[model samples]
Target: MNLVPGSEGGFAALHAWAIATAAVVAAGCALVGTLLVVRRMSLLGDAISHAVLPGIVLAVLAGGRPGGFAVLGGAVVAAVVTVLLVQALRSEGGVAEDAGTGVVFTTLFAVGVVLASALARRIDLDPSCVLYGVLEFVPFDTVAVAGLEVPRAFLTGVVVLGLVGAGLAATWKDQVFAAFDAEAARAVGVPVAAVTTGLLAATALVTVASFEAVGAILVVAMLVVPAAAAELLVRRLAWMAVVAVVLGVAAACLGYMAAYRLDTSAAGMIAVVLGLEYAVAAIVAPEDGVLARGAARARLAWRVRCEDLLARLWRADEARAGPPAATGPGDWAAAAWLRVSGRIVRDGDRWGLTAPGRAEAETVVRSHRLWEAWLGRHVELPLDHLHPPAEWIEHHLGADVRRRIEAEVGGEESDPHGRAIPRERGRPNA
Candidate 1:
């Protein structure tokens, strides 16, 4: 392909070809990976990737070139055999799925390595290339397509990607159903077995397509990492697939550039980049990410502290008592924040609620007492137990919910504790 251009071009052309090839391979892996992740069959994908090495070696020994149709066919057969073995072990031998996967893949991979070593003199395949890959050398192996020389690896990746994408599109609904609930999907006539077999075949195709770029070992990261990251970022399957492909492509480009600059392995760099993407997704995911959930907890805690302080002040005012003690650091901080926010004000040496704060405090007390009354009527809790539940529930009840509780408790004037339930903010008391 002459990717390196001297008077014609430069190494820029080679770098571009390499990066593009990596991106294509990554995209295909991500597509298949999305389904594997969703179906919890990621280990199966890993198994297929390793187990297919023997097939590739055998195909090469049989005069099939790497990244060619013959190699791909052998790889798919190997993948199917791997899956059948796993199923047989689970059903007949009562071996666990994970154990079966481990046993089958490792054993097959060992056999492949032995074959590759023994036949190294006869085959064009390199043991190092099987483990790591020869992406740098991919540009040198070109075939003419439509009168234009293109890298063989890239062409195979594109063809496999298109086929996998088309097949999935035609049966996305069935795949989704089977992934989530295979038994139910089968009951509904969704052809669960066929769908699963198709996925295994697709996994094999993508694995082999990636074999020249990332190799058999690192291809597991290409297949699983981006899809796992996408699952964290998105809720829907279609969006997850789209996000996974985008992430995988971006990682491929960045990783290739990084490897070029650092003078390291492109496959290793690509796996590193995918790990970084997953880490970023885990930290920043919307609902369940560490940062998001932490922030939510902080916000709720702050609100609860503020409302608790307000309700305490209202209770003191009702009892004609002095200001509540701000004994703890949290209490003092909440008090200072409430005063600065205009919810509390300085009155002589004590703190008092502002007009708006009084209204808010009244609502809180109303919620608390109404809940206590409702629990008293509905539950057989002791009067002492009523206060603790109401105390916690006070912060969560909205005006509408409080009003409903109020009505359901017969518009109680007093709680089970014999304390008067404050009226709604705008209601007049006779």
Candidate 2:
């Protein structure tokens, strides 16, 4: 179907084709990238993307079309060769993996650059296209399919995505097991080597597919950035892949629009958008994100302060003394919160626990004293050392655990400090 009403003359059609092509390529990259990031082979993905340039230029010189299957075959061969050379360097020459990768990919990329530059007039491939890509011109290169014109790059992306996605789906279990623990997977008879090689082949395929839309350099960003962000946002590998694909596609669409409005490189802008997405994930991700973790810590601190305030009030009531002085900002805030919550009320110049507050306060005191008794019985700590540990542990104990500790401590009525351990509000002394 025609994307725009006037297919031949519509600039909107061209823009649509370009953006769609970018999104499809981004999806493919993201799928493979999830595995790469999880396996800690992201740098290898970068190496393969750059190293595949020579293979592509060689294929183009041999009369293969830019986005054709022949070029993809050549790129896969190059990627396999890159991985082999890196392994050989590490095993035979005792070179570090990172250094070997750096040496191999840079050397191969320079060769590709030289080949492209030297044969610019002879081959149909452009050096500029290999470096930065020509996504804007992608729509102009059309192939007739099903009695309709489709951009060749888009067709190539769709084919690669289907193949990669199918391959991953078929072997996802093995891939995941190998990714998290290769030794264990191998001991369990999983094909770790085959899984790794298959992943490398998929990475090469996606890299070549993205090469036309995002080029050699920026394709690394599409490959790793979205996957890394997804890692921050989600816990499961499958969910990570899904989130990465969504993030990549969104960046491609939004970046293409932004680039069109600003007259900039679509690939570069797409990478920028991916970076922004990663930043947002780092800040707002549910479990480990900056905001979520900060909020959790704040809540823990607040609960501790509130419980400490209640315990202080209970102790004052036990001593028949005035309420403890509010010591600092945290104490003042806790006092105000207690008052608002009706846990405490102003008793002339100081705060006193209300009936409901008294019940809760007894619970805290019960936990504190019970723990102190348990520690005094079991641990060899001095009486003075017991209070600090009990103070920290009071918020964590539950009713059942408090009872178990009470039983284990031989039903002690008072702690080692001679302070009476408060009973559960309704329970009689054992």
Candidate 3:
């Protein structure tokens, strides 16, 4: 398993193993993190990632190999203790859960640091590796398996990933039920407490498995960032978990390669790459993302401007006057668009609605006056106050709702402001 000097194959194998280990461990963290995020326990994941360090150090001190069952057991126990402490502080001492978690995990992490530093010789725990991890050296520690030298960290990661994935899969329904509404789930006979405990244990197991490859500091990024990003990208719990795992694995691979090229810490680079993924996800997510929301707003604004121009021209024609002056850039753009789209035409110095344009303009004006009449009839709003609400709502009314409103207002022919309500044109709203 040792690397020979100037060995290209050896170095390539080493890098592959390291990236594989990171990807596997990242997947495990992402799976567990999905439930954590769904249940709003992401901070608890962060707490457990740091607090498990003390248990790991103690386990190593008690003669457990780094990725052994003994070490995993110790981590689970520490994770349980951390949760219990946080709850106790919340219930008995009236402390906030987040504040209590912060206090407990930091204190335990500090103790682990002191113990690791003090017992460096016996425990052989390096402080630098404890924080940032030594991903570059992961391949160096190999265990012989089936006549091949395999990295122990990679093996541990695979095992942890399988375990966490199976455990979550078996409890997916209950996990979701408990996540969205614990009280309701408890009322319906779900084992909310056991589910929560199992999640905490899984968090510890994955955190410890990732210790040698990505370490405590970067592990939280693997756990929370991918899940958070996936949440933005998908709505279903199953798809969210799948997307989170994919994102985590991608980050691990890309981040490791980037770190190798940059001669930097792979763990730090992986975290950075995860942050970048979240940023991209926030921008491009299907709904509620920055781009999607902005596009929706822009479309609405454009529609409003165009519709306002049409309604204004229609009213001018009704008033037996020339077109209104294009006061703003929006009006100018809208008028030009109307002309280009054959919705309006230039008649000398005035703009006139085309045949189709007059019908569409009548519809807009009809929707506005219908809403205003409905509000005046139902809401008892004053004459002057009706225009603004009706104006804003005119763009949103569909044909079906407009008909219903028209019916509710007893087919009123005029709004409260004495403006005649335009006929419906006997067609669906465009």
Candidate 4:
């Protein structure tokens, strides 16, 4: 094993091969996986990969070489068989869809296991390699195509990916409808069963092509996780597929490099790298991630709450002809934080807003008072109920939306509670 981590030339060649191989396979898997996920048939993709092993073993036993035409033929057959058997179990045997898939694929996988073990000596089949092919050794299997030595696996995967891509493009509308709602598609005579069978076959072909480069087990991660992550980060299905392909290719390249650096398996490294990508998306996704949007919402809510407290304190001060002599329990805590943040000041138990605090406090009061006036006009809610509802909505209303609401309420100058509605900030003092 030349463990010196291939030279730059060797590394570039290896990287190119890995990227080409992963891109083609990942695109197909993620594309189909998107449909599977949308239709809630993700478990079916899992079952198809395992179940196709027997068909491939049989093809090989019947004089078919691994990575040759026979394996692909058998794979499609196995995929179709798995689908049919699952359907049979669901309709005839009265089993649940998932349970039927479990029974069908597990049995097929066991058969493949027995055959691979029994025929190990007769064929170029290694049981471990059957489950997870030797990706590092893939570059060693060079085939001369038009006098250029290229990794056979890379070439084969590219061709398969092209075929899948072309086929999908040709039938995208039908497939999209089927995926969105199979029963509706069926009702409209969209041949849902045939479309489903075609999808399964495409998935099986992609799986087999990738099997040599990344193995069967990890392909599941590439197929599903990228699509799943992309779904989290994108709304449209087309964009989701695009994002998944990008993520898949990136993870493959990064994983391969990391594996080479650390002297580990490339497939395992890719899976780990993909997992990290998903963790990042979960934490940093805009509008949805746990950290980014949550923090943003929290900051906005806290700011609104603090401003509300300030405006209330300001009202108390106005009623007494000076700064408030005593702030409430909630406002006192808010005032302390505001004072520490230089947004407010306290002198001998009296509280007053700083220059910045006055602007912010006025905005809150404007939003609250405007909302109360609007509710009094448009809603049947009582005056007392207005403050609590406005208190919550004040965080979401922007300056423009507030202005629109202000117009809708006929430029109301006072809330239902008769307190003056503060003027918009950045305007000269009235």
The candidate scoring highest on lDDT is 2
Over 4 Å off, model 4: 1-20, 181-191, 321-390, 394-430
What tens digits encode model 4's per-residue C-alpha lDDT throughout 36-116? 777777778888888888888888888976666668889889989999999999899899998898899889989988898
Residue by residue across 309-340, what tens digits does model 3's lDDT show? 89998998899887788988888888889899
How should the candidates be ordered by lDDT, best one leading? 2, 1, 3, 4
On a 0 to 100 scale, what is the lDDT of residue 31 in model 3?
94
Better of 1 and 4 by lDDT: 1
Candidate 2, residues 287-315, lDDT tens digits: the string is 98999999999999999999899989889
RMSD per model, one decimal? 2.7, 2.7, 2.7, 5.0
Residue 353 of model 1, lDDT score = 91
Residue pairs in clash, model 3:
none
TM-score of each: 0.93, 0.92, 0.95, 0.78
By TM-score, how accurate is candidate 4?
0.78
Candidate 1 backbone collisions, by pair:
5-9, 5-10
Q: Rate the local accuracy (lDDT) of all candidates.
A: 0.92, 0.93, 0.90, 0.79
lDDT of 1 by residue, 347-419 (tens): 8999989999999998889889999899999999988888888889999998789878877887779988889
Query: For every model in order, what is the number of clashing pairs?
Result: 2, 0, 0, 0
